[model samples]
Target: MSGERAQPVREQGTEQDADVDADAASTEPEADTDAEPAPVTNGAQSVVRALENAGVEYLFGVQGGAIMPVYDALFDSEMTHVTMAHEQGAAHAADAYGIVTGKPGVCLATSGPGATNLVTGIADADMDSDPLLALAGQVPTDFVGSDAFQETDTTGVTRPVTKQNYFAGDADSVGDLVGEAFALAERGRQGPTLVDLPKDVTQGETDHEPGPARTPDTYRPAERADESAVREAAEAFAASERPVILAGGGVIKAEASEELRRFAIEHEIPVVTTMPGIGAFPEDHDLSMEWAGMHGTGYANLALTMTDCMLAVGTRFDDRLTGGVETFAPDAEIIHVDIDAAEISKNVQADYGLVGDAKAVLDQLYEAVAPTPDADEWRAQCREWKEQYPMTYEAPDDEPLKPQFVVEAVDEATPDDTIVTTGVGQHQMWACQYWEFTEPRTWVSSHGLGAMGYGLPSAIGAKVAAPDREVVCFDGDGSFLMTCQELTVAVREELDITVFVLNNEFIGMVRQWQDGFYEGRHMASEYGWMPQFDTLAEAFGAQGFRIDDYDEVADTVEEALAYDGPSVVDVHVDPAENVYPMVPSGGDNGLFALSEDQL
Candidate 1:
């Protein structure tokens, strides 16, 4: 059975396969023409068919023994399978693909180490609420609890990080399980879902064909908020003097950026975004305060701190955004809107909680409000704050290059619509602060999980998802070293991704924290020795350029961006520099530190 080719069922006719079968039959002795043909479907074929039914076009995975059957089945399928350097890279690539395409990205891996390697990416997706689906090849069911070679409880290990997970019980039901997993990953408050495919099950034979992807009948998310709550919230907005709209990642995930922009502009309200919601509102807009939180714009923080009425859409009000909950919007009556009701008031208390789709709720508010708030004075104050605490940094010609300068140069070099991915660290903060993201889905990063090695692999995924668009990654020296090996994958695939390594010779963010909070005692944070990333990129068959001074930045950037395939620019930056506008953990957002002295 393993040697036999899968006779996959497709929505489109398989005339060519039938013709091939007829040609083979004409050359052989045929018998039993009157007898009905036997079913030839296997669990691996069913799994692939289920993805086909869901219209999945790309899959990221590493081939391994337990998963060989599925990979073999994929041989005849039309979907493009990307073989990544590691299971972790596969997961991150799939995650980025999902973010860029607004669909559930698929990743696959084998048992034990392979499954464990995908944990970080899975957790990252779960934290950021990105739609992703992971299929892990498992050991045979008979060896489930006997400590079999290369075996682990894959479902149990991933359960906490997934929206839902299933262990394929048998061949006949495995296909439907994959469909259900795909639907659950993409539906309602999107997050990662998983299905554990045992080797025996995938190798087992079955004739069942999974139908179109559909959520379980019991799964239904609210599409509209309660009318009474929206009316009262609208009334609260109308009566308030200082009104602000806080847009979070959910706004982008729900495709409600336009709706959010309309509501903020129509009501003449100030707009402040969460870091994850950077592109929800255009930064150049008069009402835009950029984003608010730790390392957020001082003006955005000041606005949120002083508002009388706050309408927060699609945000969980996480600790990074709120700082100290008691001090966060103390004088404001909060109207919290979210797709998941559980997220409402989970971190911060809400005076009015609206549970529904972000776009639907924004539309409801857009229609329900009778009179817009008179916020001329409030808007003036916001402008004044922006002027007072501008996002500024100095790059002296004699000194080492600044990370902010590098980020700005990249921003200038690339188009506004270019997608930017980042590995977690100080470099990520610099990218967030400097890059003017005018479009939704342009920014991708590891937010909640703060995984360091995400940038390069995500760049690969982003490039694959939008081949026509420029995909650039801003990665820290420490972060880049974690997954630099993925450069091989990018070079092999010929992906056009430009990576700028902010080489500061230290774990910049950790060193900053230690400087401020731990009496400047830098322990293991600083890297005493590091490789020349430009040379390393060349070793991996990529275009590599080194930037030691501001003089070389512009030309080097141009050369790197001009390369037809993967490129890396190693920008040596000030080791002493640190990210500022920092609110100490559990501190007030309004009193952000502009320097280490302030901290």
Candidate 2:
């Protein structure tokens, strides 16, 4: 009785008969085998589809729990995803890619610590005005304010750094939010933008398809300057005798380098580029004075200090470029042209403010001017200054190898179209001074943020953007040590980039500052120990080479450049050598010290 099946407690007893069972089963409904199946769609698929609609082909990010749904969606898409070792590296790679392509480069990270890791790179891109789009995963919607596991307010954290930020509230509208964020990142005065995605939203089902990426209807930017303002600025240019054309990074960003070059040559004005403005005008051109600022060429600095009229375009007039705002172009009446109207008089007051795109404004100004200014005397004087303070360094056979020599050796070995990247330090200065950049986007580095460990990861991104072109990076010993782990990413991707470490066993720039300003008190600047970078490179599966003497520079550089995969060249440089033509913080640019004694 215990093993027998229990019967239902019903009033009627069971009447089991084969005919009754068959008749009852025959009345039951049959499955509709020919009906169409439900469409497969989800919030994650919508996000990926939004990117596809924007023509995004590559993404740099790291996988984690909060962002797993998006990554799972990525598995079915054709877009290539690079799983970077760290979120910071992914951000930097995306930044560099944007710099190279002149478009918004995409990066992704999970919530909390993962999102926080991308802060430095985001700040760098924000400061430099590079186009970038960052996607950050968040905790489920219900757990938003509950101090849930791995939860962080990503939008709040990135609000100040991004041009704009959005919170994805639901599966139905998350894709549109992402599309808007992408569009805003590359809009006028391009900068980084962010979209925070919640796990629940990404995992939820959705049937709505996202439209093409677009900025908000209320967003609009001026693309042309007022005609009256352009004509007035042109009149100022024509009346001045000692005039100089100052090109900034914005010129390159707006693709106005050619327009800048033509304006400078047509008007017969000497050109001086800001550090970020390098390659806006060909350095080989007769009108090119190279660049100006702290540690800039002495001649270029002299020209800027003595200029009577300045046509400054697409520059923020940062403190580094203007050592002492009181003395910067003191005698010159400034005509500042920038896409962002806020930069018109923020740092250096402008006599004429032309707010528009760089190329369009340049063209309008060019049309307004009837004839060029008379500046032959000023041109001759600029040439004289170049001869007086040449950018040259001494390299003796018995002394330690000069970093300048290594830079020149590498530059000579590479092709003219090769791209160069650098980390923040003395090596960065050396690379800026020695290598001649002749094209826009060829020189990419952290300018405003001055972040260390930017070189290697940036090189990885640059290589990916322009695989046909050669990519080289100049990193200091201290800077290289900060992100040397990125070598593994480069090696794994088989990127063809050659990095030269100007190894002096110290934070060379800090040591130079300590010597000059702190009475030679060697603080924590000098490293007590340094690993053999050559062997370290080998461990990362990259080709390694070393140079201890001047004799080994050429061949070692050639060998490194010839390698099909990533390579690192550790060149032991003179520790005692220091960057000259220094304008001490807040000092007068006109009176820059040429040596420590002068300081």
Candidate 3:
């Protein structure tokens, strides 16, 4: 699931003057209806009402003939629609919007190519458990299997990527289908869901007053943790001398970071996170050992290796975290708490599994158990490890600056509340290791799918949702090139975001692996030619800055942050530099192939 594949290049499209028609209804059902109110018109109009019922403020998409009817409805409605160059950009934006707002971010696309383009972003959301709703305009039911213009099976393509997908056949089904999609997207283990509406369904008249979006009759997310299980888990934690709290993205998804921190503090337990779990607890917390995975901090890995009891919350214990299930936390008795029952003991065997919402379970555990006060010695060892093997890197005294230095500089210049997003690969790993994330919903990335070109579009979405916050996207040269056209979208929307490109001129992470593991042979990892980043940004009407010298980093970052509108900062970094403290694929954290100088 984590294997690399060739990424799709973002396509550039302009409205080619082709057109369509729609039945636009009143935005509201009629404020004061003396006459039998205009029977609420078509399914597209009803769909908008349902979205409002579910509290959707923005719809991200690219306009096309198949989806033109929905766009027509938006003409008279209050809902804001953000236009992107491609459907992929729209879906990525929606994904980030959901991540930041804790709501099912909505996206729309036309049939065929548009829907297919959204597949990767939907897959990214599902892999990361980000809540999202993707709506696609399909061909009419009568034209099924007829090879109609711009026709494709949206449901079939999205089935594997989405949490659930539905094909709405008639106008009457639109409202409830939209509502149900939202509910399924947000409930029990959040993820992306879809409702494919045929063009006929959108244009067809419907008198059925589409009611408010409601939670389904049968589907209800479990909000309460088992009392006995909580008590037992807490007792085990209190009993163990070297208990470590392993928090995953589940903690953030459950909004349980506060409870997690409190539990760790009261019990004097060291805390480590999975890759997607960066912001669950403050990285600077006294008991925090930061992330524990393939590219995790050395001391954090050591903590995982040494722990006697691991109270893991909202984490799936994925391959990256476990390294190899047989050797992972070999000495630790794991107490896994997650909202999804299927995830419990799916990978790593859990001595105790509490299947419920992470926040709910942690709340009960905090109330039920008393911590042992004699964990001072164990706590001291965690602190000692932190001191001995801190995540330290010294910059090279030359041009083409160290990438870590750029991340650190950006972190220092930006406000602590800045929403930082990343495109996958070295920049992402560097940001995770270097940037001190203090708040939840602030660090966003495609951790599961490792999708390139996710940062700029997601940052655009985050900025759209939180207009006042400073959103910085840390992107690699390769990833940036993947969706660079989105900068034009950012400029047109007047989104206040700064995309900092670490120009390494290579597929840096893969090259690093090849160098270390494959006897220094990197065949297809390097890009022989690098794009002129500043020129591209300027062409997109965004302010651009290129910094190659280490001395100018602080000034460049400050200027870029101070810019009034969307901007791009390209910091040319040493192409040969690699992310360190790395555990090779399927290797234990303790068996890291560290840099010779590091060892």
The 0-to-1 C-alpha lDDT of every candidate, in the order given, reads 0.91, 0.89, 0.85
- Tens digits of per-residue lDDT for model 1 on 91-194? 99999999999999999999999899999999999999999999999999999999998898898999999999999999998998999999999989999999
For residue 33, model 2's alpha carbon misses the true position, in angstroms, by: 30
lDDT of 3: 0.85
In model 1, the clashing pairs are none
User: How far does residue 319 in candidate 1 sit from its true spot (Å)?
Assistant: 0.8
RMSD in Å for all candidates: 5.9, 13.2, 7.0
Give the 10-residue window scoring lowest on summed lDDT in candidate 2. 1-10
Better of 1 and 2 by TM-score: 1
Candidate 2 lDDT over residue span 150-266, tens digit each = 899898999999999988988989888889988988878999999899999999999878899999899887889999998998998899999999999999999999899888888
**Residue 563 displacement (Å), model 1:** 0.7
lDDT of 3 by residue, 25-103 (tens): 3333545545443356899887877887788888889878888888877776656788887889999999999999888
Q: Of the candidates shown, which would achieve the greatest TM-score relative to the real structure?
A: 1
TM-score of each: 0.94, 0.93, 0.93
Which candidate wins on lDDT? 1
- What TM-score does candidate 2 get on C-alpha atoms? 0.93
Q: Candidate 1's C-alpha lDDT?
A: 0.91
> Which of the two candidates, 2 or 3, achieves a greater lDDT against the reference?
2
